[model samples]
Target: MQYSQLGRTGATVSRLVLGTMNFGPHTAEDDAFAIMDRALEQGVTFFDTANVYGGKEHRGWTEEIVGRWLARSGRREEIVLATKVFGEMGPGRNDRGLSALNIRRAVDASLRRLQTDHIDLYQMHHVDRSAPWDEIWQAMEVLVAQGKISYVGSSNFAGWHIAQASEAARARHGLGLVSEQSLYNLLSRHVELEVLPAAEHYGLGVIPWSPLAGGKLGGRSEKGVRRQNANTRFDSEGLNDQLGKWEEFCSERDLTPGQAALAWLLHRPGVLGPIIGPRTMEQLDSAIDAVDISLSDEDLAALDEIFPGPGGPAPEAYAW
Candidate 1:
């Protein structure tokens, strides 16, 4: 597996993040453990999960599954474990958001479920509009002081939100957001419009979720078509034509659609890695193999022609 520093930090991580979102709800614990085992053995040391994973009825179930895996394997020191906050774990108003109260409660709860003493990366699952930056930072400072969380991260944040959060942390002489997780892939280039640029400016690594565009880029045309139509992106005749071209291009390069898609992200700016949530072992292997499939200039140019970005970054992408 390829390795790079996490953003501007000195800590290094794999280019492929092993996302555990499907652990409890979709994958049995045994299968999840096997996947995590293989990921670590393969040198993919970054694992990302969330507090609200495992669906609504069994919140935190995913983390519990991971906790068991970590205990069984005794490999906590080998992986960079990441989990999120800001999702409602219960009905109480204090159960959600990034307020100082929830942040304090959530980290402790997550630590217990994770069966770990410290979280390598504690991410805010979303931008909680109700929580002021001062309050959030104060809580994070306490966690850092207490050694409960080594670093802080953010997910699903707008470019402006990263700016606001980072600036707030800077004023306090904090490390700020070491990473940002966003939906980014060959078919999803929205983050390139601003978020990627902002992350680069702030030295936050870009961890892309849904890196395969939910399997549309996985070479399974039948399944891809089925999912795309539901999402309204490939329902139109013109889009179907583009997807057909996409498959044809992958075939010509002797690459699986998934490998090509991941390779593209590996080449994108500010991207530390793409989070690959594999339900099966084969899928995990496919993503790991993608790290070595270098894309030439011509190959990238063709991909750009197939799945164009937002013209570049704004305001140059828009005003200029």
Candidate 2:
């Protein structure tokens, strides 16, 4: 696996990060543990997870599972751990958001679950319009001083929001966001017009989620049609039963859909890493292998013809 600096921080992460969104819901605990082991064995040093993914019954045990994997494997130092906050956790009104009170309470809870004193990268999962920038930055800087988190990042934020937060941090708290994470895939190119350029301009490492447009770019297709009936989750948002428009690009180039899709984003400027969460080990292997598939200028030009711009026509599915 290739490694690169996680934004301006000294820490380095694998170009392809092992995402644990499906760990508790889609994958059993044993299987999740095995996935982590296999990924680490394959030189995947970066792991991404969120607090709410394990189901409330486990009380954040998804993070606990990763903690156990580190303990059992004795390879904590070998990996760069990344996780997120700011998702609804319980009935309480304060259970979510970027407010200082919640950020403090959440980090303590995360640390206890992860069995670690310091988090390598702590991320805000969503923007909290309720909290002022000063409040959020103050909490984050406190965590840094307390050794609870090393660096901070933002996810699912727009370019303007990122700029506002950065300006607040630098002008007031003297602590700034080091990276930005957003959805970026062959089917979803919305981030290219603003978010990508903003990250490059501000030196924020860009971590792309759903690099394959969920599984749309990786699934089987024939005659430019994809069988969306295979997964219930795939059947929603007017995207059901449609093959992604990028299929035409892949067919012309004789490349696998997933390869063409991933290769395209890998070439996008300022992308520090791509998050890949596969249900099965075989699927994971295919995602990892995409790094080796190179797309030439002609290939890119042809692909562009299928989905030409930031406001291009929608793809077969929007999940990825």
Evaluate model 2: give its lDDT.
0.79
CA lDDT, candidate 2, residue 69: 76
Quick one: how many clashes does candidate 1 have?
0
- Per-residue lDDT tens digits of candidate 1, residues 108-208? 99999999999989999999998899999999999989999989999999999999999999999998999999989877788888899999999999999
Residue 178, model 2: Cα distance from true site in angstroms? 1.3
The parts of candidate 1 lying over 4 Å away from their true place are 221-237
Which residue pairs in candidate 2 collide?
Answer: 213-320, 214-320
- Tens-place lDDT digits, model 2, residues 169-251: 88974758888989887557788777876777777898888777656776566564554434343345645323445665667
Question: Per-residue error at 2 for model 2, in Å?
Answer: 1.5
- Backbone collision count in every prediction? 0, 2
